[model samples]
Target: MNMSTTSTFPQTDGVMTPRRVAGAYLAEIRSECLRYLRNPGFMLPLMLFPAVFYLMFGVLMNHGHADAARYLLASYGVFGVMGPGLFGFGASLALERDGGLLTLKRALPMPPGAYLLGKMAMAMVVSGLVMVLMLLLGVFAAHVPLSGAQILGLLALGVFGVLPFCALGMFVGTLIKGQGAPGLLNLVYLPMAFLSGLWFPLSAMPSWLAAIAPVWPSYHLNIIAQRVVGLSDAPVLAHVWILLGVAVGLLWLASRRLRRHG
Candidate 1:
């Protein structure tokens, strides 16, 4: 559907229930995604983070063990995709909520799905860009070679990698205040990355630290990404399903929170 077609959404119980205006939703999604693009603040870290990890663990420090470079190249690539899902999505949602825009938007005839779908679309867009940058580093600088099929497979892995985090981000946004979102996300991001075996293998951590790895989505995502990149023996589809399950559970929790507060 083109943007020009105006569909009149019928009111249900004195409120117009938003039907999906594909074009309108797409436009809004694009606009929402563009918000980050206009500001260069987010770009620098996303572009540099993989390289930073590469340099720190891959070359200079060499703390990741023998296959550290390859392992980190894939691991950081997955983490790069996740950073946007967690940080950007949470930041935007919390800001809109505290600004009272979500309330205003809810009063409109727009579909309830639009808000969420917009977030998902924005997450996908941002994560896709982040993955591209990370992959470029892997190919050009990190000395990791990926074939055409592997690239396609990597895209699938990246998408699945972000889904659960996107759900958690939504949940986090609902729970945290706007002004505190940046700090809250950072708190969650760094700890989760460290504990979930993203920075290094679970085996390398202390026993207590290793004990917590099973509870995290990032751990599962790491294994899944490893499988996708041909680095592990785990079944790729199973982990993707597990990640989907986690996303679905978080989305449900977010729904409950939104309804309770709405």
Candidate 2:
């Protein structure tokens, strides 16, 4: 029996090598990317909605206006990054939990964190793609002038800036059933975007609305993006701290809920 088992299991001791652990993570990430890419209902809206909106408002409407193009580019980039983090985690996770996939994965022998990390990796990738699409429209279509560093900075921001929203989405996923997640997230998503001034400058909003804009993560993200693109001189350290805090706090809450509920 020992000889037969040793022949079947190469490791012999039943210990997972480091390579095996890494492969598990890579496999999970690959599966996540494939799953989302294959779902047109999910992928199309996440990828195109912001790009279309940017083309209409940032490119066509703001044609030949460099300042408008720059501002909208920064704002819309934040808007674009929000979708993947929110829907990808919030809606899909709820649906997966309903389908019993989360439980199945928990019963698997893989690392516990791999599941969430896989979703996060996919979100970051989608966020990066969305930023690329927006930057292309801003540069070629709108004729916005941005240096290489600025362009790279904005791209990096979109890729990493998605974490707080991901945490928020995770928390939301733990709160409701699958069918309700999308609608509830939309309620949070659209209003937050508008309130954060992603659609337009807060200067145009009422004084009270403008005063409270800083409460939104998107607002702080927009400030950092604006600073990166040279549209604003706002100090970035405070905004960075705020976003970090939001991400950490929401993630802690979500993990607790997932443990208790899932």
Candidate 3:
């Protein structure tokens, strides 16, 4: 006598209900947040460095100069937010890919975007914390005069302003090895901050340097930030458009690379 057996598998599309999709994203975000929270080495520096800079430059060095404190607050806030976007997305993604975690995530029963979204949420959380610290130092410690609306505006900017850097970092992550990601990102980060006039007003830089400052995304962000703080009357629309274009372009390129390489 002979026996025959047959097996049937569930269709992949049938498993992805809206409720499950939402849960997957939430779970991923929670895990990502918890993982970073547990890593004090990473979180401490990411959160503290900007506050330290703000305290040193905006408060102590300024010696109660209202205008200088206000200016540095805007500049350092942009500088602060850039770190998480670049390091959180760029370094983490590259390291996970190298460690085989990214592949395992792809093989798991979760949304394709859950991983990236989780990291993005974590970065925003860090960015918000850093921004809040900067604001507190600016308001109470440094005595920079910021109205309620201005404080809220800068907070909102700090939260969402990380996206452009996230896209750029994502692209860079896809292009480099895990070990090289941090170094390469720092190369991009610090120099971009300086060249974008995040440390000093463009007017204070060389004529050629000031002329090229507009080429950096941070310059536009700083412009908008200064406007938020009532320090600059520069038009905001052009900067917004430029940033939006840069983010979309980098995200497009990053997605293509991830699909091909991963």
Candidate 4:
């Protein structure tokens, strides 16, 4: 008896279907981000919050701390970038999960990777725009006094720092019911920002604040930015490690949650 070998061949339906699903996800994300942009009132508040916080803490009410502008710029930049990650992506994830979007995706034949990949891509794009807004506020409006290299470094800290928090936000969205999402998100974002000293340098705050600062994701994120803005020549390995660890941990948790839900 001769055994017949199956020849490898491309499946037409397989190709088009996944492509269309991925495309649709992309389109949906773009639509969501653009909706925020179209209404400046919503996005503008996010842009202004960090700047206001920086000014209120680091300038107008500062107690003559060392390098206030530079330090505050970095901190606010961290807080600024995280807005899109938490508020933006959190809301998106909440809406999708609550509306049975992710559940629906479970029935589809497309690769599961596309669901997450599309969200991450969307998050990056939206966060990038918010970063630009924060950068302008830090530089021109706030007068943070940073160099070109420092500027780029802050951007890295801002963008890279969002990853873990975004993952965490997604996980949170998964856990909470829809009606409680917005309030729950605010509860997390506001306290974490203050606790992390995004409004003031931990050094100037209570010593206990500094001790607890590292535990908040914003602390490590801002630490890198502070070094970049104020101590541009300092080694950043430690800060980078912190961001990576947070991102990895959150991502792992988010992945597990997604699998369980699916």
Candidate 5:
């Protein structure tokens, strides 16, 4: 009877193996990537806005100033990353939540982290494409000279820097309705860009206003990008820690809100 039962049931654990879990996670990431790529409204703005701005300000109106071109290259790179991180997490998640998508996803047998991580992976992919396009424009059109190391460093920072913005977006998504997310994101995105000096130098602003530069994550990110391009000498580790702290805190808040609502 025991042998017959074993033969019928099979001698195996019910839990998924690590490889199976990883496959599922990767599948989720692929789905997220495809979803974002298929949406022209999302993809177009994300790809074009930064490129066009770089062309107009960094290349065309750069006024024979090589330094200006290089500086804008770094600054616009920061600007490039912000769009994917903010809108990807904020607007997308809010829409999903309001449309009952998240509820449906939750009912699936997949791991919860898969969903969040998939979204993050998608953002990273989009952010990476933006970085590549910006760098290409900087090299070919703007003629901004950068060392191989500097280019690599800027790319790395651009990818990693999406975290704090994702956290901020998640927090915003959890708090607002889907319909309001795009408007709210624009309100946050543009002000933060202008205030953080992504469009211009903070030093050009009033001293009091410049003092608030450190208050924005984008400012810190720009500082790091500048350091990569020999534009700033600020302490790098301090900026890294500040971003880490902000990401952690915002993620905590977002998780709490999700729990309450879920």
Candidate 6:
């Protein structure tokens, strides 16, 4: 059989039912999650860096400043979520594209969306883990006061906020060679984190530097996150809309690139 030809699976009544589609999606998600978890090189850094950063900045450095702890908790949570989305999607997609795995997947009976969905699912799961760890440290270790509602809201936002970064990762993966993806992602990731006020307040920087915040999705995410703790006065919906727009635009660009490369 030609590898380019789609494989056929057993079906009932010659129709793909909702149950079957759901099963396929679950299978893909499981596979992706396992693949991510098994890679210590990837998973360790993704899971550890954010937590460590939170401990250093949000806990130790905050030095009994509840306000600072609350701020860093939210900022680091956003930073934590960005890793699994940006690096996960960027590196995985680039490797798959280079290894011809994408072509093989295309020939399979799986829904095309399953590939992206699996990645998104993995990123969200990791995001949730990061948020939980951060929350524990913030509430107990750092003594950051947060109501139950605020905690829940922060977790929800962190998980969903990975969408734009995932789209961004896909775009970057499609644009670069597989071997260079990691370096490229680090360069973009670290600088964006600093510029977007994830590590510290952008207001402390030069006015011109602070002016660049809106250009990065991370900045908008931080704005909404800060708003959750009463640090920012910007409308939450506005920041969400900005992220939604960026996600849509990046997804479109990535799809176009994939089509050309495919």
lDDT values for all models: 0.77, 0.90, 0.89, 0.71, 0.90, 0.88
Candidate 2 per-residue lDDT, tens place, 1-262, comes to 4447444655456577899989999999999988887888988898788888888988777647788889998998999999999999999889999999999998888786999999999999989989998899888888888999999998999899999999999989999977999999999998999999999899989999999998889999999999999988979999999999999999999999999989
- Higher-lDDT candidate among 2 and 4? 2
Compared with the true structure, what per-residue lDDT tens digits does model 4 show for residues 1-262? 6465578565674556656876877775676556666766557767788767776876677665647666776777778777777766676677777888777877866455666655665566656666776678667765666678877776666656678778777777777756577778888988998889887557678898789887887877776676777755567688778777877787788778767874
Per-residue lDDT over 111-211 for candidate 5, one digit per residue giving the tens place of the 0 to 100 score: 76898999999998899889999999999998888899998987887788888999999889998977999999999998999999999898788888799
Clash list (residue pairs), candidate 3: none
- Over 1-262, each residue of candidate 3 has an lDDT whose tens digit, in order, gives 5354466455585567788889989999999988987888778877787788888877877765789889999999999999889998998988888889999988877787888899889889888988998998888888787889999999999999999999898999999867989999999998999999888778889999999998899999999999999997878998999999998999899989999998
Give the worst 10-residue stretch by lDDT in candidate 2: 1-10
User: By lDDT, is 4 or 6 better?
Assistant: 6
Candidate numbers sorted by TM-score from highest down: 2, 5, 3, 6, 1, 4
- How does candidate 6 fare on TM-score? 0.92
Q: Of models 3 and 6, which has the larger TM-score?
A: 3
Q: List TM-scores for all candidates, in order.
A: 0.86, 0.95, 0.93, 0.81, 0.94, 0.92
RMSD to truth, every model = 5.1, 2.3, 4.0, 6.7, 3.4, 4.6
Question: In model 5, which runs have C-alpha deviations exceeding 4 angstroms?
Answer: 1-14
Q: How well is each residue in 148-226 modelled by candidate 1, as lDDT tens digits?
A: 8877777766665787888888889889867899789889888988898888878899999899787888888888777
Model 2's alpha-carbon lDDT is 0.90
Better of 2 and 5 by TM-score: 2
Tens digit of per-residue lDDT, candidate 6, span 1-262 = 6655477655554578788989999999999999888889987888788889989988876766778888888998899889988988998899899988998999887886999999999988887877888888878888888888889988898789899999999999999867889899999899999999899888788889899888999999998889887776777898899999999999999999999876
Provide backbone clash counts, one per model. 1, 0, 0, 0, 0, 0
Model 1: pairs clashing at backbone N, Cα or C within 3 Å: 18-111
